[model samples]
Target: MRAPVAMKKVVISLFAILAGTSFALAADTGCDAFKWPVEREQALFPSAPAAQSGAALTVGEAVDFSLAAVDTISFEVPPGHAPAAGTFGATARVTVPPEGELQFSLSDDAWIDVVQDGKTVKSAAFSGVKNCPGIRKSLRFKLAGGAAIIQLSGAKKADLKVAVLTPE
Candidate 1:
């Protein structure tokens, strides 16, 4: 068991090195898409009083992901000051192009999930990124015409970007 785990890590690490892997919306999209809006929006954390809400974002809205952990990554709260379970959450919406794939890097010690039509498609564990502090790890998901919902749980106020790629 331990051997397999170690081997898997090596395989993933190599894959990252090889596939060093968004934006905008269509006229049919419900919301307006911007050029990866970083300046337009603000960061939310698990604390700060104001950042203490689990708002299920409306699809097609211009928003970024906020994790619930120590403020070590992009949009983060302080360490030891991490929020309790369910205090932090996030969502990223992506339009599936017939058949497409989504991939992104995230922190390792984070609880991330991918949901489609309320039904969870996949889930996994990530160990912080190599050489990248705070940022978890990388994840890849393949989907069809259905909607893609990337949810970030656990980390109480961190920053994570989303991208939909490899449309076919």
Candidate 2:
């Protein structure tokens, strides 16, 4: 009788622990917590094809870029923040339409600067969350629409996945 009761208690404790773990996992993947829906970006991240650094980027395409040391790439405009030693960076070009609000999503934490006509385009808004599975940060820029350079710097990793999206 005593052995059976002890066994039952152990089973109940194990179930409770499993339940809590499941809940935590669910919360970590709650990517919808962003200000706007990120379903398109989220879906593209997993299978997006890789593109060379400095390649021309298309709107709504997620591309993985291989980064070099910060000192190696020649940025169209100086990076908004000076990259510290050991940081990685890269650059790419894109064309924006007039009166457009573009959202740039990144797979890892990094500093993003949009330069058009020799000036840095100011970001209209930004959002970031750690619990989101793939994307780590996003920035929305209001641009006059022309050729622009996307300067990515101060990243901790050597490779980054990025998507330039026109929000839905």
Candidate 3:
């Protein structure tokens, strides 16, 4: 009887070990699966300018648009740090085609400023919209053909999508 009890204990311990190992392997495999998609995006949009960190913006074939991570952006907090803590930012160089309008949109939780020729054309802060549902703000500006800089800032790390549209 003592021998049988010892054998049973050993079997249970082996089963627990196997189960834990399997779970760990599955978790690692799942993380690896997500890496490929990010790698593919980086390969396809090789020409896009690199952000301070994270992935580079992907320029759409038909339209000039970029989806970028906010955490990678390097933001400069005001001297007084008026905004709440945890603010970050990034800038992107965009080309505005003739007769095209630059449409900048971001999650309601973020703040954005579009500047051209050292002039701030549009700026907004939506921090008060916490209770609002799906509250995304977009600003459209008539852009002349040439280079433009977009400055983005936010209190939280999130993704920002920017697009430039031309008349069909």
TM-score: which candidate is best? 2
Worst 10 residues of 3 by lDDT: 124-133
> Considering lDDT, which of the candidate structures 1 and 3 is the better prediction for this target?
3
TM-score between candidate 3 and the true structure: 0.44
Note the Cα lDDT for every prediction shown: 0.42, 0.87, 0.45
Model 1 regions more than 4 Å off? 1-87, 107-109, 123-130, 161-168
For model 1, how does the per-residue alpha-carbon lDDT over 62-126 read when each residue is reduced to its tens digit? 33354544222332222223435545555445665564555444433445566676566552322
Error of 2 at 158 (Å): 0.8
Taking the tens digit of each residue's C-alpha lDDT, what string does model 2 give over 58-149? Answer: 99898988888989989988888998889998899999977677999999888999998899988998888787888888889998778889
TM-score of each: 0.41, 0.81, 0.44
Which candidate order results from sorting by TM-score in descending order? 2, 3, 1
Quick one: ranking by lDDT, best first?
A: 2, 3, 1
Mark the 10 consecutive residues where model 2 has the least summed lDDT. Answer: 27-36
User: 100, model 2: CA deviation in Å?
Assistant: 2.0
